[model samples]
Target: MSSEHERGDKKGQFCSIPAKPKCGDCPHPKDYIEVCKPTGWFDHTFKRFVNAKDPFTFEKKFEAHHLVCVAPVTQILLSNDGINSVIEQTKWCINNKDNMIAMPLWGHTVKWYCEVEESISVDEVADVINDAMKAPKFKNIPQHDYDHNCKEGYTWEVEVEVEKLADKVKEQGHKLKGKALEGKLNKLSSDFRSRLLDDRGTRKGGTHAAWKLAQKEPPDPDWCQPFSMASDSKVSSKGFPVRVFNGQVAKWVNRIAKAISSGV
Candidate 1:
């Protein structure tokens, strides 16, 4: 087993943990996951109006073998690198595991965050993000915004695809109102899923990239330099959705721990 001091150099690029070399300068737990709650204006406003409660805390702890990866939840939901970031981080956690590493869990919810040690210019980050957003996964985003519920934030890729289907119908000179349009979308969605259920092509775009990366040979040193969404339905009357905490972190950690113990 590695000493707590040794874990610092082994942490992921975006790890939320305090760096081992710098741990003496901080008071946070050296072995536990740290929830990041930035003090920016957007975050402050959201918490003030939406989720007034403090960040979630977990009663459960991670096993020694766990090498968890955390991503910036806000960036993944709104930035150009959103999809790419999650998939990339997940793959990193999976591919970099060793015998001591087990139950590679990833945190994707809004409260999670990551940082880079090296200084990177905003423009460089934006360029990579723009490229990610332009990937085939988001090809169907309409030229114009069809839904005006920006209060809850932008819709997911699935919603964008449904809107695209509606646009195609409109282009064909067929006007279907309300239920009729809803029915058509339902059918389209069902058909699309049915066809893709057994095909690897269904995982195209960001997911596909992650899948491909996982298949490649592991890095010689098993290390790499660090690089660094919300649903509407549950919106509160405050005009934004409040974050939900339901022991998810504990569940995730336990699931991974179980897998490792079972030799999975």
Candidate 2:
């Protein structure tokens, strides 16, 4: 029988442990897996938060040593199954509503939090570490108000558009009364402002030039007639009627308006 099979038989399970490399110098997967297990387990532990699970219970029950115990299991899961599965499983844990709300046994919840905190995309833990490393004095110092200078003119125009759009949309039987509507308008305005800024700065002349260069002959649809509305003039395309007034564009406009008003 193969050594690997023999080892598996001894362990009493068909586990996928890698063979240790010869020459006493090569790094074994087992060692690396062991080392990384804690991080993976921690990731799993925190995943509970996303599903509305009470993480505090698990946190209280498991001391630091327990974290160490689950690390290898986490590593094994991650290596065998893949990260996406890990993420999905954790999500399932969080979404399990049938369990006791006070003290859930959902392993998935803990896993999800750990993944979010330590995972490549969210990296909450890394962000915390980075924030901690930053000089505390820097927090007190005011940030450079570059947006005030660069976006002041654009912001005013956008705000006018937002107010106009809000009025227009309200007239069209869309409810712009609630906080949610206001928030949507604000976001729409901000998005419009950002698009305008980007268009004006980077892609304005270049986009035209590129289009001109790409054409084999004269354009099929004449470029002289404006193809689309400018950022401030465009109505939101969001499906929600209320959101049309207070989406990304409106938010940006509001910010600009606030900045301008504060300055004055």
Q: Tell me how far the alpha carbon of residue 120 in candidate 1 is from the true structure, in angstroms, after superposition.
A: 41
* Whole-model alpha-carbon lDDT for candidate 2: 0.27
TM value for model 1: 0.21
TM agreement with the true structure for every prediction: 0.21, 0.19
Note the Cα lDDT for every prediction shown. 0.26, 0.27
The per-residue C-alpha lDDT of model 1 at residue 64 equals 23
Task: Report the Cα lDDT for candidate 1.
Answer: 0.26
Off by over 4 Å in 1: 1-54, 58-160, 172-174, 178-180, 191-264
Leading candidate by TM-score? 1
What is the overall TM-score of model 2 with all chains considered together? Answer: 0.19
lDDT of 2 by residue, 173-246 (tens): 54433344434434553454344334432332322232222221332222211111233233212111111122
The clash tally of candidate 1 reads 0
